[model samples]
Target: MTERPTTTTNAGIPAPSDEFSQSVGPNGPLLLQDHYLIQKMAQFNRERVPERVVHAKGGGAYGVLQITEDVSQFTKAGLFQKGAETDLLLRFSTVAGELGSADSARDPRGFAIKLYTGQGNYDLVGNNTPIFFIRDPQKFSDFIHSQKRRADTHLRDNNMQWDFWTLSPESAHQVTFLMSDRGTPASWRHMNGYGSHTFLWYNADGAKFWVKYHFKTDQGIKNFTGAEADAMKSVDPDHHLRDLRTAIASGDHPAWTLQIQIMPFEDAAEYRFNPFDLTKVWPHGDYPPIDIGKLTLNRNPENYFAEIEQAAFDPANLVPGIGASPDKMLQGRLFSYPDTHRYRIGPNYLQLPVNRPKAPVHSYNKDGPMTYVNSGDPVYAPNSMGGPVADPELWKGESYAVAGEIIRSAYVLHPEDDDYGQPRTLWEKVLSDTDRAHLVANIVGHASAPEVTADMKVRVVEYWRNIAKDLGDHVAKGLAVNGS
Candidate 1:
């Protein structure tokens, strides 16, 4: 009726003054005895969660993945069985951007999905493109650093980005893709996504296969020209996030067709190219994608912080039929995602409702900072107090054989490990004439930014030439740079 109430601290104790801190005297310093003031200051200092190191800026939504075809011959994951449907959440993001970065920038989009399945939670974390910049995990931190701001000037140096890519020759393919129109997708719903790393899928019959995922958009592939994207950056920085929400709210559910390209286990050892390389892609002509399911986003989160920001996806969240391969970056991600979640959220991040498994959780996991439940059962295994034991009979994953030296070294080089040919193919066959022109313009524009050095500009042309002489010459001409 008249007035609501006074503000309180996190502990909910009342009688507070936000205007001034608890001080001994009007002109003196603050007092530590006032727990409320201390709590307020402490909470203010920690109000912001540590943004994700990569994929820091993102938008998330609730969805469902439904099996559209029978793929039981490949794997026995209940989510992939015919006619099966599972609740899911997808978070789309821009890599290397801050939490306030523009959405329409020309960058690789983070496409991470988590499925709450009967067996457990399955995370298919990937990107919009089918290939990556580097194949090793140790270089991951360095690579991301190059794409980020510099220490001295506090600005994103294009010279730094190009230097990293040009030095790491394996980045040719992804760099070419980035400079193309596909990088600035029209909207989150209009672009396709891929699980770029090679994964393993084993069947009930004990046969294993290497698999790659393709989530083709149902809204049709649409992209913005460099000019259009640049103009939109000024107009709407959050266009993608807003479009996704509006479409879902108006009952226009955005969807994708989940496809898979599987290679036989025996063929992987003798394949023409390294099947597990993150920087390369298997030719679709060799192993075509087979449609398997549909993923549709029909719901929006009620609370962005609780549902979207707290959602975590880890490559280590493997199920019975599906597992990981020898992709080095992927191998590193299996450990890093969970560790970061623990640090950013808390030790009990999984206990949050947004991340909890739909299936019953029976573990000896007891109390932590935010643990919601503490069943009065035995807290440890190997006790006569009737604690649950590990069950291997439900869906035991098939066994895989391994033999290698214990020492650390690079993956054995295949005959086609060089980075030139595939990217050349992309320039010649995939990009149309208009697309090629736009690519040249885009490369020139980025290279001519005020921050790039004259030396790095020369290197940029040389890097483009490494992909193809004509493409490189065109970029050089567009930039009006001499052959020096």
Candidate 2:
């Protein structure tokens, strides 16, 4: 064999011993002067970083987004150009569970993507479902608190979850999807991913269009039944992660077709429902999907902690031609995502290899913990020395006038913007007979838990009843309560 490399400490100093603590005697108390032993123990103590507030458990892989069709008429974003192939990272996660929680639990999955382009990094942070429980950001923390363990008993409480869902009428659409078998996806590759928010896309000629992203899995939709998912919790809590790693390793790479629905910028003003509403979707009949590209994951990460765990995605990382819409939840995330990363990771989190953009960074931001970039000379702008300057007109997106009164309010309702309309459509027209049965059974199983009180069950019945008369009737009947 070739000569084996010598073991060393983190600072590259040769370690005196690899398997022993430096004690006064072999069996006596240890000495602080043993720098190697002290360093080893200290590094071990700090090995783990703080877990994320939400989406704590996740796995990701290296991928490429290949643009197969032209969408340049809709947007001038470099990554959207025809035949452009951009490297990307995709992280799949459970929304409410902790780092150690089982992956088979009934919960929404995070489908966050980070695209590395010549311009910069663009993060599309979204979920598996197109629609969400609530449209506004003000109730976000309250929603998470209800899903998390209770303070009183430090246990997950069904009562708290149902109480929040029943009280918030806006939750009907996502709750319907969650109660269906689609919630417990068989694996990350089998389910679809969506950039649920409507985003603004502007062309080089300054024409603006509204767009939504859908990543349809080529592996096909697959899910586990309620009983099957429960069994998976004990059989293999990390089933989803394992499946993805194994599949990629075996050369069975998973791919998704990227389709987008585009609407004329002016049409959103007169749409039947609030198009910006997170609880609703733009009807496929009105705006059919146009195939734009394909995303395929072929590489497993060599180091999970450095590549996946340290990866940070922020919705605010938009390219010049692609910009934010009036969606409230998306607007809220633009601020929250970067802020959380700063606190959880260091202030210089962007300097990490996974999050660092492939393009050169010439930011004025300087001096924080773990900052590796020197960025020497003329850090301040408008200086006598040569420095980077901003060009306001270069690849800029279109801007709209903002002239609204400063007041606290919900979205101004459109002609058909009732809370129950889309959910009612989903129950009546979308789900098949078997899917409907599973949805009903799942809701009844959760709502009829012993922790849930009779009064809450009455409200839960009323909540589902508002979505569909038959659904509420069945849930009420299952809970042995008279129809409210």
Candidate 3:
């Protein structure tokens, strides 16, 4: 059999040689007429797209979400309909890291999922931890700025991070968690995912239930010590990514049992804890997780760039049954996430194969750069020709009565809004003796950074002291010994 010959073309027409461009003479400079060379150089220069501002370092997998338990009473979404299953893509990332940053960095892990249901795309954008550093979105930028490098040194400053945390008392709960054992997960498979903010679900009968998503890892919880995590960072910078890919490839598929804590819509008004506060969590004793389904990641992406990098998950992508709540962070993210996608990816990014809804999409949005799908029919609505018409019966989603002043006022925080309760609970109730020891060690190590001042260190120690006198003393002892 004859082998196929290498061919280059101006436009599919064969060219003589790709190695050398046409020139005036053998030793002469390349001619300006070498369109192929020019084209190649131009395309190469424009090869890369912009990276995400947060959750930049990530690993993703393709999977199927199987509804194992009946939650039809809570949500009428087809994905949760009795025994229904849907294709899903999940991405896990470190919030403070760049694309090439070490996977084992001490940061919140982004646990975002994009579900392609028959109804539409549903994205549950969340993190590994249940609560966040800040309750309000207004302080979000400032919190992130503190986590990032300082302006003068362009170096990650412990002072900035600690200063922000000390000022924003709301950060105590998440800060405590970050300094705990769970901060450095063993791998993506060993950690759980959480819908950090409250969401809403409406059943077939138009009854709404506030919910918090809890994805418990089927592999069981596992985490690394501070020293172990730091060692792994040096040994394998992409350890988490590699672990996820290898596990899936070896048929050791990782799974999460999807559970939801549902509260009646009326309860939000009188709940003990502020349900809308991103910094607080609804106690399991009050609202327990009713099993909804199982999410299994059984397949690795064939190409990271095509399948994972281009994947966009937005909290706003809600279906008929699933809806948004008054959680300030959730509300802010509903607008910001998609807007960021539009800026990072193109305006028609949803048209990308990775992000496109599996179900048919009909919209007036048209004529953008890289618009792969042509409506073929007229793009405008109210046309003489019948295009897609909105079905009020299907489109009219669940609604609740809204009666509030149109003023920019803060949501009333609960009386128990002191950040100590949960952290104290975590310290005394949740963590083992070994875990507590490690937590102190981690906090001391982080606090001992040369850039962090003595005052800031004392403030952090005092902050923890507010959580639990014992925990605060232990951390203070470690700080003192470490010369913080």
Q: lDDT: which candidate is best?
A: 2
Q: How far does residue 188 in candidate 3 sit from its true spot (Å)?
A: 0.3
Q: Give the TM-score of candidate 1.
A: 0.93
lDDT of the candidates, in the order given? 0.90, 0.93, 0.88
TM-score of 3: 0.95
The order by descending TM-score is 2, 3, 1
RMSD of model 2 against the true structure:
1.1
Q: Cα lDDT for residue 304, model 1?
A: 84
lDDT of 2 at 235: 100
TM-score of each prediction: 0.93, 0.98, 0.95
Q: Model 2, 130-230: lDDT tens per residue?
A: 98988889999999999999998999989999999988888999999999999999999999999999999999998999999999999999999999999
Evaluate model 3: give its lDDT. Answer: 0.88
Q: Write the per-residue lDDT of candidate 3 for residues 1-484, one digit (tens) a residue.
A: 9998868663676766668888989998988898877877887887667888888999999999998888878778888887888999999999988899999999999999999999889999999999999977888889898998788988999988999998888888899899987999999999999988888888878778898999999999999899999999999999999999999999999999998999989998877778888888899899987887899998898989888888999999998888888888888898999999899888999999999999998887888898878787677888878788877555344678878778776555466656778888988999899988998989999999998888888898888888888887888887773322
Q: Model 1 — which ten-residue stretch has the worst lDDT?
A: 391-400
